[model samples]
Target: MITATPRPSATPAHLRDASLVDPLRVRRAGPGDAAALVALSEPFVRAGALRRRPFDVYAARAADFLVAEEPGGLLHGCLALRVHPDAEPGAAAAGVLYNFCVARQRQGSGLGARLLGAALTGARAQSLAALFTATTGSGRLFLRHGFAPVPQGLAPRAWARTLDPRRGARVLARAL
Candidate 1:
């Protein structure tokens, strides 16, 4: 059975405070961030906002992650650049953005934009010709970031299943 994602019982007090003051801070997540990352992502997983991988999987891959934390350290949103094994020698490396989320109340603060920009920057640095992701709600944001959809039936690994008949997450790519 799929696990249910947890919603905030109430906005954390610090977020209320941040709403009155600074809204966010972005930084690399470290070893200590595993639990918080899980908390931040659990809701999405439960809601199918992301594919549910075991906690250990996330922890094992944590180094590629980043978070937008409120001043009180509540996890607001996260994004990661997970490298895929090269399919061809000397080919441009490729990576994907996973678990992209913004806290329920913080959805419009440009956090997704910030997160995607960082992912794209990392992709360029790695000489990746393109960056890819599967979106849950809309692909417009990815399009704005220069990602175009992969043609129907030609979707890449993991991405093919991200989309369903109605709410299918289309595969998008941005040339690096």
Candidate 2:
């Protein structure tokens, strides 16, 4: 298992105190974290809540992702920021958040909100106007954080898949 360096809690006390979720240490992901990342994401991948992405892809894109590691070096959750590095500057600085999963034992423990905050912080730093994601569950969480459903045709292929022909997806975006 990959170990995560400890850090102060990433979430504020108010949010942490109000929920059943525990605190987490959020950090940038590294190549050594690929396997853990894959494992953390499997449940969603199998349920079609997340796309089938390979471990190597996580390693390759480690620079664009973040992980919430518990004190013991175990990965509780992850969130990735997807965007083309060379895309036009004025195009709203788009990003799609993917592979966000909290360990089964840690679900509902404020870790997801902390991860989302970190990703949104990264997006704003990159001059992104908004951050987007698709959720099969937790629509309320996104809504609580100011995300709203985006119209069809506005999302990319990966994101559009969230809107499957068999079962529709819920798209949400938050302006940074």
Candidate 3:
């Protein structure tokens, strides 16, 4: 039999009050944010909703991330947009969204939607031809944001090549 340990929630106790909906500003992440990124995504990783990634990887690719932050340096959410050039047969550029996470206290308060919106805006800013993401969950948020079901082959070839078969993630795409 396997036993699981009860880890303390990453959310601070004071922030758990459901009525407290503080303003969270979404911004691009920097190299110094690796530790917080790992902490913010740890629960999702443990829940099997996200693939586990190391601190070094986050640090190395910090520019690909966007984080939701409140005053006093608290991070409530994060998402990564990895731009893939030479993505398709015709040399179309695209972005692959990944590592999306929100603190439990911030979920359902439109923070997730806000993050997705920011990512879409960023993709547009970069003039990406399309945006793609793979999700193991219901993907209702992505669907609501105009991402529809797509074959893995439709995603950026380099990204699709790296997907783990065992994770069974469904690919979704939306044109920019």
Candidate 4:
């Protein structure tokens, strides 16, 4: 139920026409948001920017997601943080960030940053030791947020096994 503070109006000149809405909120995703989450991720799936995930996948992992929503309940973006399953009790957890996407029209309006902030906050709340993400494109956004390029082998084994080598994904990590 953490809410983002209102964004400033200091948008870059190129994005002056951006439909940057105020009062945006980031919250934990619930079962009811499954469809919207799928819809939000569809374009990325088609573009191969993200792997396709069925509605049932979202439903089953709903608690692992965070969504950016407008006052009227329209979803603006979504991010998922998957905690690695521990091999033994009391081991510190690691996490994988995936399925991050922003509404096409809102792409340059800072919604991604808001959603990322919320997800990171949630990760810290869960006491994760570090977070990892794989990106097919540039890792600029994640780098700016403190992530550093790392060998794929450094990722949690369960998560690394899920990566597709053909995707040429660059692995990045940030310790909490």
Give the TM-score of each candidate: 0.76, 0.77, 0.85, 0.85
Candidate 2 residue lDDT tens string, 63-144: 7779988678899888898863324555665678877887888777677788888888888898876677877776887898
Q: State each candidate's clash count.
A: 3, 1, 0, 0
lDDT of 1 by residue, 18-111 (tens): 3355567878888788888888888888897677767787788788897888789888888988776555787766677777878887787777
Weakest 10 consecutive residues of candidate 4 by summed lDDT: 14-23
User: In what order do the candidates fall by lDDT, top score first?
Assistant: 3, 4, 2, 1
Cα distance off (Å), candidate 4, residue 107: 1.2
* lDDT per residue (tens digit) for residues 17-117 in model 3: 53365567889999999999999999999999998999999999999999999888889999999999973477769999999999999799888888999
Query: What TM-score does structure 1 among the candidates reach?
Result: 0.76
Q: Which of the two candidates, 1 or 2, achieves a greater TM-score against the reference?
A: 2
In angstroms, how far off is 140's CA in candidate 4? 1.3
lDDT at 129, model 2 = 69
Candidate 4, clashing residue pairs? none
lDDT of 1: 0.75
Model 4 bad stretches (over 4 Å): 1-21
lDDT of 2 at 147: 92
lDDT of each: 0.75, 0.77, 0.92, 0.89
